[model samples]
Target: MNINKEENHVQSVVRAAHILQLVANSDHPITINQLSEETNLNRTTVWRLLETLEFLHYVERDLPTKGYQLGYAPYRLFSKNNMYLSLIRKARPLLEKLRDEINETVLLSVPKHNGTLTIDQIDAPHSIRPINLVNRLLPSHCTSNGKLLLSRLSIEEFNLILDRELEPITRFTITDPTLLQEELNWVRDHGFSLSLREWDESENGMSVEITDNRNELIGFISLLGPYQRLSKDKMLTLAPKIKSTAKEIAEKLS
Candidate 1:
């Protein structure tokens, strides 16, 4: 048995994982020199490992800072983990309660890059409810949950998304950047957002922000239904209850 060769392979894997961890834990992009100093590996070895990790999208180079940050791979893995499952599990009862109270579809969504990813959903009792949006990445500018989540991003991050051509999902969708900016400003100030037949001509939704104990935005809870049943006035009237429900879910998760 070539024990030395096997040991070398294992050592390489361990060093790579250590480098990835350092990048993940950093508050800002981490330079290769910082990784090498922390890992006690030589610069060449660190660079080679980083090259492999970057190729696999486990780490990505922050071009502006010339440093490394976590790539898409970790987030994809995180989405499938027990922790993510635990979040859904802990919040399910409250979501169900909200749905029962309002008899409207309830959606749980989180920010996914420039969009919103619906993680879980509770369908409304009415047969005429909106279609299921679970496991879909919908445009942030067109959905209530998307807008509420986007409102929590830093100004630089928000601008990056805004710089993209905002696609219109429906005639009512906010394709005008200036108007969208105004809408998001209102959402940030009020801690909620509304989408009146924006994503779909037949459906309307209102969303409330969910935050952790530190008040950091984590996700959103949205109530959706047919436009006839969930008119703008009705949604505004129910806003307090929906916001309270979101707070309960956040507390449960925290």
Candidate 2:
């Protein structure tokens, strides 16, 4: 093989991989121009690589913004990875126990960009409970799990999220950036966070952090229910129990 030709091929593969990393790390959907600027590559090269990646299901276009985001291939690979599966398996019994004890929804969620993604949940036994939120991406500014996760991020990372619009889901949702920042500070101090009719008018929730062996936040354990059943006072009363359950999960994962 020609040495120069082989080197060029290797360089192209490296550039493509770099592009993928940039898209994966972005909190918002990234445009071809943005990718080009970030990767220091020409627009044409970036577009070509994105097209190939899109064809392979590694990335896809966000139609609304005409930007790019991770596609199904990465998620498929993640699902096959034993780590996440192990986490779910190890945490299930404890989550079930919490649900049984409280008769409210208990969930395991982790940060996804600027939002929280519910990985698993044990639904409340009540017929009139809040709808299932598993596998949903929820706003960081308006959710208990989301706020808990956000509190763990670095100041720079947190600012990146605040730079974007804080869409209000309900009148109770905190849309003012300054107020949200103050609330996050309180969450950091309190070791727990709450969403009192913020995401849904009838729903309320509270969450505690789950840390790894290194004491790094890895996820959140949340309790959610109708406002009538999960009043602020009741959630405060149950906070210790939820924190205890989160500790057990962290110990098991470690």
Candidate with the greatest TM-score versus the true structure:
2
- Relative to the true structure, candidate 2 has a C-alpha RMSD (angstroms) of 10.9
Please report, as a residue range, the 10-residue window in candidate 1 with the lowest summed lDDT.
Answer: 1-10
If scored against the real structure, what TM-score would every candidate get?
A: 0.66, 0.67
Q: What's the distance in Å from true for residue 163, model 1?
A: 2.2
User: Residue-wise lDDT of candidate 1 within 1-254, one digit each (tens)?
Assistant: 22224454787787888888889778679999998788777899999999999999999999999999999998777777644577788889999988888898999888777688888999977868766677678888899988877777788987888788888889998988789889999997887899999999998999988888898878889888889989999999999998898888887776
lDDT of 2: 0.86
* The 10-residue segment with the lowest total lDDT in model 2: 1-10
TM-score of 2: 0.67
What stretches of model 2 exceed 4 Å from their correct place? 1-83
Positional deviation of residue 95's Cα in model 2 after best superposition, in angstroms: 0.8
Kindly report which residue stretches of model 1 are placed more than 4 angstroms away from their true locations once superposed: 1-83
